[model samples]
Target: MTSPTSRRTVLTAALAAAAGAGTVASAASASAAPTSPAGSSAAPGALVDNRFWHTYTDWRCGTGDGTRVLPGPRPGVVIAVPAGRTDYTDPHTGRTAAWDYATWTSSVHRSAVPATEVIASWNARTPTGTWIQVELSGVYGDGTATPWFVMGRWAAGDGDIRRTSVDGQGDPHSSVWTDTFSVDDPASGVRLVSYRLRLTLYRTPGSRLTPTVWRVGAMASDVPDRFTVPASTPAPARELPVPRYSQNVHIGQYPEYDNGGEAWCSPTSSQMIIEHWGRRPTAEDLAWVKPGLPDPQVCHAARQTYDYQYEGCGNWPFNAAYAATYRDLNAVVTRLGSLTDVERLIRAGIPVITSQSFLKEELTGAGYGTAGHLMTVIGFTPDGDVVANDPASPDNDAVRRFYRRREFENIWLRTKRYDAAGKVRSGTGGVCYVYWPTRTTPGQQRVLRSLGLL
Candidate 1:
């Protein structure tokens, strides 16, 4: 969980320049009201903003190298390039065998309204000895664009390859790396209008290593402070029997993946779902992981979904993408308006992964407070309380816990409140990671269609 204070610092800095120019106040006010369903008048807190995916363009390799598009993970194409030395010499080092790079840029996307923040995310698979890095920039009010900022350098399977200022990698073959960057102010007197992304692939010369990129996207929005309450009543509360998996039990199991259990909540909740669907990873999938662990698949999930920049496995989109790797599963990161929306998924037999934070007194049964945490909402209890598989518990057996309905809803849906620092910090705003059968049954399709997700 991210602390409210830290969130406030980032949000404040990002919106500061805009506020000074008196631009942010209007944008925020415009989006403060909610949007309504199609064919209906707008509701309170119903502002709608667009999020777009800008595909790669003008891909080219430096001298002595080549580039081509290859088949990528479902519906997406990958840019593949070979390892070779660049023709240009390094001015500082005066060396001829400098690292080579293949580059691609995304088309600029203009938002419907001025955006408060832009988040960039990507997925890639690289062989040993090769790596990928991403950079982002934005244009505000048709003025000069912000300088390109490095998102991160990533390689799968290698634990030492951290997302930092350091370039290149020692070895290859890691799982896909997905990370998000919140774009902040570039200059004063500029209202953000458009944004762009650049991806660079680097590898050792003659290493025969090729890296493949699956998908890259961005979400830009003026995150509202509140959401409209659903007009319909929630389904009667009833607890669903969900299996438990605790992060505490796995502590110290894999130091490479955020020192193991302490940070494994996201993957642990994901594992429970994978098992519920009867699609647990086979022995071969866990072969690379050291033996003797109770659920090696959880470890595999952690490694595959880990975000180098965030330095944790709790990224919402990354976790959803990881679950999609399994057959018969499709996942996405989205925000739900109310618990009724959650109940719809539950009735369809789909568990939801939600991000939330609360003070100890706010949520009973959970003894700690988190800046942010992920839990599986398996079902609701009779009387409309929450029945969740909370991986943050002390042990697997203790993972099942309940929370008062009103308290849980307030914490989950309306987390953007004043923090101890007297700054208004924003929460995820009811964000959820939902994984369902790629091929849904008629019943499932009905529920999804009702929610406008089908």
Candidate 2:
């Protein structure tokens, strides 16, 4: 549980007032600045900052049976709830609501970065049988709007679609969900001139469960030079001594969490970091997991971070938020500038979970092509090569692998690709998950200060 900070207090008060009046509160509107060409080739810059636009002041809301906007988990956050029952004909079971939905739509705005991709994210608190689906549409240079694309539908717990909890009871739990969609393909002449988002909330009838939403926002990015200049001498091959954990070892262990280990990369990497910090889950916490698992804690993480709507556990922000749920720990998902930036975190004894995609021949040692995969960047060799606990390895003994610094950097930074038909496809670029304890150690503080992130 998180301690009450000033932001949390303000958000709680705002939500309570809104809930009492059964009305939505307005928030200030935000807009992106005009786009400017990035600087010299040697010094690329961020196209979009990692801040969220939470003030729904200008957003429009709609509901089939009335709706209420409540407060979210933190300040600048709000929840959209559907009100009244949709099943008015069934007098005997009038409480059984019909198919009701509450929606919020954002005003369209042009990007200042000539964005090729847009990432939508949200934090949701949902009861059993409740879920949310998000869609995005982009306005092209021709002033034509792209068709609504389903980013993802999200709910807590496992399973391919939205359903009640495993035990047939409503479990009030929350998790963060994010999806990155392609908007502008350099090959295509259509540049995204403006974009808008729509969020729909759904719940089952006879269930009073209401879904809550927070931090709904989007980030845009333009392609950067994949091969930026490396350090003059490769920062003295420094690698933090961390434990190696493998996801392959747990394959077929839990069917509910994507048939076990094959898709457990994100949670597995997160579990490794949590254990490295000496904050393993207690027996009581893992009590819900089935028995006979070698590491119940890992299974617990897999279950907690699993995304029902996405049918995968690799949601970027969800894994980071899962780490934050632990006492004295905090985490965030963001994009890093370069390998040198990653080194700063390693030097501070922090392990970073990074997303990457590669064909079998593209990356040495790893004989596979994954549209997306997560691994822990633990350290660097004396020659500046990367040393990572790659969970995609075939077995536990092969989990730790080394790669050429340039090769690893290329795969990590540049994830966009094209098909034979000349269509664009990609994952989130230069994305990473950073987890740190709330009470920072001296080493952690030094690294944070040097990076100007503290």
Candidate 3:
């Protein structure tokens, strides 16, 4: 959904339309910025950089109602299976194989009626007929009251909605009836709409584990461009000279593996920023929050009422508060979706640190590949140039440099995950931050301080 020209108009429309609406109102009134279930809705104090506020909406998923448009921005689902393997087994396969798989089934409804039921099955077969079964339980949402439809099979094969039924290993699978939903008029002040799709899977006997694969399609819209990673090349090294922020303070003072796991992008980026500041950072100093956190099992079984597993990364800003942390740093996580927002932050004097390579693709449409991998925005150049620190360049050597304003804006929105795909799908929103020590000492305090726990 596109942003309205004025917040006043949008707010008025939302409030008026929400009078009789139930779930729709909940989403439109979602926090303007990051928030926890228990936190107040008032604006945050130290979010110092607020330029990316609107990016959250731009990256919102599922026909704009939150189901997250699949193949639209991120992977729809992820499954892990345990099994025994030997030299002949391709253990690393992402697809389901004979040794094991999983099954999920669900019944969903729209406006309180059974809308549809579905079962998705996936698996990988070995030449020897040994195989694993993987299944998906899903509900289809056309953004109307009808719950999304799902089809399940006991055997591994394609499931079709048009067909009355597909063959399955004979087992009793229950049936659920759902309702039909429709939003016939947008002029009725209800342009945004949604539906439900709940799913789960059951296993068949004798298979070591279930190996399965399930493909999903929108009954009303096209499949999304979920897997595209944009590319961009940085400017030629000679023209833009990097600048120096703190000549005496070298980032090498800190290193990766100090905070979160280094394999993921957010943690790795956070580690780089802390090192650049010539200060050590701890997990306490920065909040590494993401959405849909703490798998169902972790949340249910955790000992504490406020379990970390239940809180997911989307709560980073809150974690910052919990950790008694100060200052958050990292690149524009949402790509082109937040350019105007970043501009606002840089103007706020927040000492934003990020990689120059990120904007490279934006400058040169999907043009990726460069060595100036990690850089930070130190200050604006003369005549309003965007000054940055390039640690990789020989001339810059972590020195600050400048680029044209026009070029910077163009590149900003182009490189983010949101910009790469225009928005985030449900259960896929992500956040990143760096934890730099307030002082140059290494201790648990640094980590706690960054996380705001201390």
The residue ranges of model 1 lying beyond 4 angstroms of the native Cα positions read 1-73, 80-101, 127-131, 141-144, 163-193, 201-212, 226-232, 236-243, 252-256, 282-291, 305-310, 316-321, 324-331, 347-349, 418-426, 436-454
Residue 157, model 3: Cα distance from true site in angstroms: 39
lDDT of 2: 0.57
Better of 1 and 3 by TM-score: 1
Where is the poorest 10-residue window by lDDT in model 2? 1-10
Residues 65-176 of candidate 3 have per-residue lDDT tens digits of 1122123322232223322221212222223322222222111111111112121211111122222222212222323222222222112111210101111111112222
TM-score of the candidate numbered 1?
Answer: 0.68
Clashing residue pairs, backbone N/CA/C < 3 A, model 2: 15-71, 27-57, 239-379, 251-261
> For model 2, how does the per-residue alpha-carbon lDDT over 63-161 read when each residue is reduced to its tens digit?
222344453333222234454333312222234434455566555555655565666655566556666555555655665545454455555543223
Clashes of 1: 23
lDDT of 1 by residue, 325-426 (tens): 566566656556678878888887888888876666667778877667788899988778888998888777888888766777777877365444555665
- Number of the top-ranking candidate, with TM-score as the measure: 1
Candidate 3: list runs displaced more than 4 Å.
1-141, 144-269, 275-340, 353-374, 395-398, 415-454
The alpha-carbon lDDT assigned to residue 31 of candidate 3 equals 15
TM-score of candidate 2 against the unseen true structure = 0.64
